[model samples]
Target: MASFRVKGGLKLKGEIIPQGAKNEALQVICAVLLSPEDITIDKIPDIRDVNKLIELLSDMGVTVRKNGPESYTFNAAAIDLDFLETQDFLDKASALRGSVMILGPLLARFGTGKLSKPGGDKIGRRRMDTHFTGFQKLGATFRYDKKKEIYHIDGSDLRGCYMLLDEASVTGTANIIMAAVMAKGKTTIYNAACEPYIQQLCGMLNRMGAKISGVGSNLLQIEGVGYLAGTTHTLLPDMIEIGSFIGLAAMTQSEITIKQVQADKLGIIPEIFRRMGIKLDIIGDDIHVPSQKHYEIETFIDGSILTIADAIWPGFTPDLLSIVLVTATQAKGTVLVHQKMFESRLFFVDKLIDMGAQIILCDPHRATVIGLDRKYPLRGIRMTSPDIRAGVALLIAAMSAEGTSVIDNVEQIDRGYQFIDKRLNALGASIERID
Candidate 1:
């Protein structure tokens, strides 16, 4: 059990480089299993989730080599299929939701796959039906072992087919694509997620001999190939971390530059922060946010209070809603933080309220925040991080408060952000990790 002791009221300065995307790394690493050849990946974020997946791969007999601090070479040429049926593999698979992605690659290369009920943050009901349904659509026979809580999928006779997904599930879309790429014929997926990560995965698959089109659209087409070749891939910057940095600068009145953001891919994130009256400069690929004594939240064109809500890609991301909520606490006006995707994410607002933030927890999905406008500084207090996003939000609040605050169960934070305390400390913020 680790904890973070954050000293508040310090203005951070200097530049901080964002790590490679955690979400993308998880998918790309699992995709390595689709080929018998070696695949080299760069810009891999050093975080808990990714390391856990890599450990799982190593345990399954994949040859994982460290090319550099942020690079690796994975050769799945001699994977042990028998390991999938063991209790150790099941327990490891159940530790993170990203482990579910390995099923698609395993089924694609070996004709069979097994998955335990995936585990992740307790934010909402994340159903795996979409992933299973997509597999079944591609001619894979799927079944659930009720007593063991395992899903079994066989892809020995898989053939490409049409699938209209119920929603734009990101992981589900990636999983199905990995499975469909090696099927017998053409496969078309409608209502597919078009996030940058998905596009990158599609591009990588194409480079590795898979035929996939419609890179940035809701409809994707794939022509099955016999086997994929090993190829190198570099992950995109972590957009979620960029959003968190933006909110951190605003809440703490800091002048921080976030480096290597690749601005165009950020979509609506910068604008969402600007709507909260946070001034940001897009200097090349870096985001420079200057110190602010006061900032105001904007209203709608019809004079209604602004509302920040999450949606699929091209819309606000649900991962940063907690950051936006905590950032709005010090802004001039009020904004409604609506977390439409997750039910339990907003429950952490109670900790912010105890820290002197003015937030009304309307329900599981929405909260109305009345900005304190810097009239009264938040008082630091102790808290437990419930999930990854909420954990980061609590850290932001603690950093902007009036005294030292301790955040326990910080493993939740480590799972996503890499060396968060050290990185922020380099910019002059005081965050100490306590074991």
Candidate 2:
């Protein structure tokens, strides 16, 4: 129950090297359980979710060796299946939604996996039907114990089969892919999630001797291999953090350089922000945001108002919508911020409204932000951080507001970000974390 005491209106200036992809790292770390050999992963972010998954692995008796500050080697040869059935394991694993990914590797390696209902951000209704359905199609038996609220999956005779997913769920596709890698026959997953994270996982699994084809595409074909050997993989820069930084710099009107950004992989994020009338100078692999005195949203070609909504891959990421919505507060024109993936994500706009923002929450999924154009500076107030993305948005709001703001629930922010306070402090942001 910690809070951040932030002094607003400081123009932070400096360079920030984005952390490793948190979402990608989660999937890749779980893929280590697919192989019994030495699997080395580099550029791992030291965040709460990653650490929680690693702790879950350690508790399950996996051999975890820290090679350096941002590297680790995992060997799943001695994973204890008996530990997975205990209440102690459920208590720890249920706290993190990433723990659900372990089902695939565990079922693939040990022929059985057990899990309690996983917990994560309450942004919307995140269904597990896609994951369970994919597993059932792979010749596995899935049983639910409603009394204990546990899912029991037994893949004793798991045989690969062709199936199409109803939705392209990132984590669900990853879980199925991990399980299919060691199955007895060929497995084809149509309508799979082909994000950079899933592609990286497939690439790493391929390097480890799994036969996977059509990478970076929704139609994935995997030929089951008897076993997978160990391999080393390095994660790309966190694109979410990069976008967050872009919004942060614009909100505070600061000049900041983001170093080592994988610019090519960040599809449409920079462009989406540009539509909001913010300028971005891409110097080689870095993105530089200059101090802006004014920014205005652009209308559509037909003279209609601009609408920015989230969708699947090759579309604007849902994670960055919160930041984008917050950045639109000081803009000169109105824009519709549509969050289609999650239902309750736009509820955080009420907090922004309290800070003197001109926002109209149309419904659960859409909000129209009328730009204040800095006519009146926002007055900071006490607020609570709801989820990871919303928490960062509030932090950005607090940093650009006129007065001091106290944001409670720092734990929600820490779950996804890696030493955010310490890192932002280096860039001249006055955020004091109090316990």
Candidate 3:
């Protein structure tokens, strides 16, 4: 277990570039299996989950080559179908939630896909019904082994059909799109997830010979093609990480510039921070957050308490709710953070309460933060990270708190952010990684 010894109350300065989008990286990397041709991806973040997926592909006989520090060329022409039955595959696939995505491409191209029950952040019950349900709609046979906790799907003669999704799940939509691209007929998907990452995947698929329309809308149409060719794709900057940096700047009263943020794709993230009283300027593609001693939360036009909730894209992202909750601690006035997607994400508030933030755990789904206005600064304390988002939130809290704080299980943070400590240290924050 790795821990971070963070010295609190240091104001960070200079610029930080957000890494490649982790969510998009997971989806696109899995898409490489859709074609046997060479697929080169640039801006691949060097994080644990993405690296694990790459390794999984390599173990399955996909030839992978490093083109640069953050570039890779993958050729999946010689995949070993039998490897899916191995215990090694079972163990590895069971550990990553993203591994479930490989199912669509494998079933589409090779007619069969096998996977163990996937694991990821212990936030709540992340159901796979959407994925399997979409597959079944596309003429795939689905089976689950309760005893082994494994999933099996067969798409020997996949025929596309129109379907309305139960939820606009990003991964679910991506999986179904990948499968339908090579099906026998046209597939129309209503209520599809239209996030930027999903659009990127759809665009890349189109560039690779897929007949997809409605790239940035809730409705998607796909015409089955005989084959797909490989193409080079570059991932967008992680919006979640950019949001985190914005919160970090405000919490510590730092002047930090986040560069090449792809501002248009951020979708209300900047406005969400502005509502929290953080002053941020969008200069070209960079977000410049100036130093602030005090920022006040905004109320609704009707003068009601401001509530920040997560919904599907175009709404605020649920991934940054933890950062919002932590950032609201030192601001003026109050805000309610409603984490609609995950039930257990708000449980980390107790740790922030321990650090002197006035937060009411309204329930499993909501938290109300009464800002201290920086009058009562948080005091550092030893704590353990429960998940990636909460871990980074706690690190932000500790950075703005008085004295030093020790955060255990920093591997959670490492899974998302690349060289976080070193990057923040360059901007004048004091953080030491202890093994």
* Candidate 2 Cα errors over 4 Å, as ranges: none
In the range 252-343, model 2's lDDT, one tens digit per residue, is 99999999998998989999999999999989999999999888999999989899998889888999999999999998999999998999
User: Candidate 1 on 1-435: residue-level lDDT in tens?
Assistant: 999999999999999999999999999999999999999999999999999999999999999999999999999999999999999999999998999999888878889998899999989899988898999998889888999899888888888999999989999999999999998899999999999999999989999999999989999999999989999999999999999999999999999999999999999999999999999999999999999999999999999999999999988889999999999999999999999988899999999999999999999999999999999999999999999999999999999999999999999999999999999999999999999
Alpha-carbon shift of residue 347 in model 3 (angstroms): 0.5
Structural similarity to truth (TM-score) of each candidate: 0.99, 0.99, 0.99
What are the per-residue Cα lDDT tens digits for candidate 3 across 46-158? 99999999999999999999999999999999999999999999999998999999988998899899999999999999999889999999999978899999888889988
List CA RMSD, all candidates: 0.7, 0.8, 0.5
Model 3 CA deviation exceeding 4 Å by range: none
Q: What's the candidate order when arranged by decreasing lDDT?
A: 3, 1, 2
Model 2 lDDT at residue 404: 98
* Candidate achieving the largest lDDT: 3
After superposition, the stretches of candidate 1 with alpha carbons farther than 4 Å from their true spots are none
Task: List lDDT for all candidates, in order.
Answer: 0.94, 0.93, 0.96
Better of 1 and 3 by lDDT: 3
